[model samples]
Target: MPITEILSYGFMQRALIAGTLVAVLCAILGVFLVLRRLSLIGDGLAHVTFGSVAVLLLTRVGAQSVSLAAIPLVMLASLGILRLTDKARIYGDTAIGIVSSLGIASGVVLASVAGGFNVDLFSYLFGSILAISPMETWIAAALFLIVLVAIALYYHDLFAIIFDEELARSSGIRVAAINRLLVLLTALTVVLAMKVMGIMLISALLIFPAVTALQVARGFRSTIVIAAVCAVVSVVGGIFVSFVANLPTGGVIVLVNAVLFVAAYAFRRCKE
Candidate 1:
């Protein structure tokens, strides 16, 4: 479809706006998470998102309300997961695996007990850009702004924590508080992104763009810029391609990001 044709529909316009915001949020949060080797944090939180959303769906709650409700639930889960990883004597990935499995199992049971997959459930799992509404677009915009401002305000502290937690602690940066703040942001970003990337694939959005950027960028600032650019392009291109092909939007977006990562890898290899 032509640009004009795509913009003619209200849903498309809303989806594009929401998707772009989600892309930026995920990309920015992703850089630090990837650097900290905490990429699975997105996956674990997404599973919690899936389970919580399923429970909300079973209760007949509205979509926007469900999204909002998931935020606190996800934040609590994130905190618990972080605490476990930090002090429970368990491997971080092991903690993530346990929580991820529990969340997935709970989601499956909720769906079955609620009489199986409906359009709403399917939409949460796979995503449907055509189903986004104006309200969702607004919410996405607000979250985007919050994420942007928060990241900008704490850029130096976050940078310190990301590279060396002990050094940051010794520097009196309150590493624990910074870690909690980062996890909270990750939880929020995971929930917001689920609408665009789906629970099953949200981690890809949170990791791929940053990793791709890292392949070529020489510095932190350059990596973030490249990641944000790649993320926006992937989201826009995925929406367009999905619209044209009538494919699943989340999967298509992840695929686009994968292709970008591959291209980046090839470019880096050639340069070397």
Candidate 2:
């Protein structure tokens, strides 16, 4: 199928729009998360989302309602994780590991009690981009705008925080509050992107692009720009290729990013 023919379909258009927004959201926030050594937070929150979605599904809530409900629940979980790491004796990675395990176990228990996995649950677990509705597209657009505005407003503070947490705190940047805000943004991004990448592979979107860019880019701003470009290209190219090949959209997109990361790694190695 030609590009024009693909865009001619409404579902394809919605998928592209939503995928692009999700790519941007993941790439931009992912940079800071990588710098802050909080990449696992994405994985942890994704697991939390999986469990939350399962609980909602078990209760017979609509998918859209489950999605909406997952946002606050995931954010609260993100905050709780942060608190555990900061206030308690546990380390960050350990806290994330514990929560991740709990989330997966909860999801499994809920799914088993709900009569095992169904198509609807499978879609959330592995994604169903081609099935996205117009309302989901609108929601994604709104989320994109929110992410863009929030990043724009806090760009400098985030930059400072990313570079040196103690220095940022010394400079009155409210490091604790900003860190929580970053986690909150990440939780929102995870939930929204889960619609495209699913719970199993969503963390790749949050980690791969930024890591790929770091392999090549020399400066922070350049790295961010490159990561966003890599992310958007991966999404658009994956969607197109998946349509032509009849492959899984989420899997194809993550594979595309993986390829990009490998290429970037090779390029960096060659340069060195």
Candidate 3:
């Protein structure tokens, strides 16, 4: 089928728009996340998002409520977890590992107890790029706006704080506050993308493109710009590939990102 044919369907169109918006937002967030060495944080949040979705399923929250109510709660919880980790002087790495296991366990147990919610549990697990709703499309757009503003307003502070939180705090940056904001934004973007990207591998969408950009970028500004562009390309390409190949949309998108990262890393390694 012609690429145009994919966009002709209402669902396909919605998916495409949703994917585009999410691809951009996730890429930008991933830039800072990577710079801050918070890659595992993305993975943990992904699991938490899955757990939250499981709750929505168990609670019999209407489909619309999943992204709205559950997502924020998950984000807030993630922020709180981070704070607890920070304040307790627990290593973030260990905390992420602990949190990830608990979050994913919650999802699985809830799934089992409910005797399973939606057969579309597979879709939530791996993402179904073809099933985006119009409401999801709007939500993604609004989130992108918010994320972009946050990035612009806090760019220098974030970069500094990510490099050295104690130093940034000493220099008058609210490192703790900024970290909270970043985690919340990350959680929000992850939720928005969960429909198209799926919880099972949504972290790939957040990390891979930013990773690819990081390989070639000389500085933060260039990295963010390149990551955003690469993300758009990956989403559009992955959607089309999955459509044509009849692959799992989330897996296909993540596979594409994986291939690109490997290729980029190889090229950079050879150059160095």
List, residue by residue over 1-272, the lDDT tens digit for candidate 3: 88777779898888788888899888988988887877767778778888888888888887766788667767876786687688878877777787788888998899889896576566677777687777777877887798889988988988998789889989999888898888888888877877888786778888899889989888888998989888888888888898888887787888888888888899889989
Candidate 1 segments whose C-alpha is farther than 4 A from its true place: none
Candidate 2's residue-wise lDDT over 100-202, tens digit each? 8888889999999999987787898898888889988888888789878988999999999999988998999998888888999998899898889989999
Q: Which 10 consecutive positions of candidate 1 have the poorest summed lDDT?
A: 126-135
TM-score of each: 0.97, 0.97, 0.94
Question: CA lDDT, every prediction?
Answer: 0.89, 0.90, 0.82
* Candidate ordering by lDDT (highest first): 2, 1, 3
lDDT score for residue 238 of model 2? 91
Weakest 10 consecutive residues of candidate 2 by summed lDDT: 61-70
lDDT of candidate 3 vs native? Answer: 0.82
Backbone clashes in model 3, listed as residue pairs: none
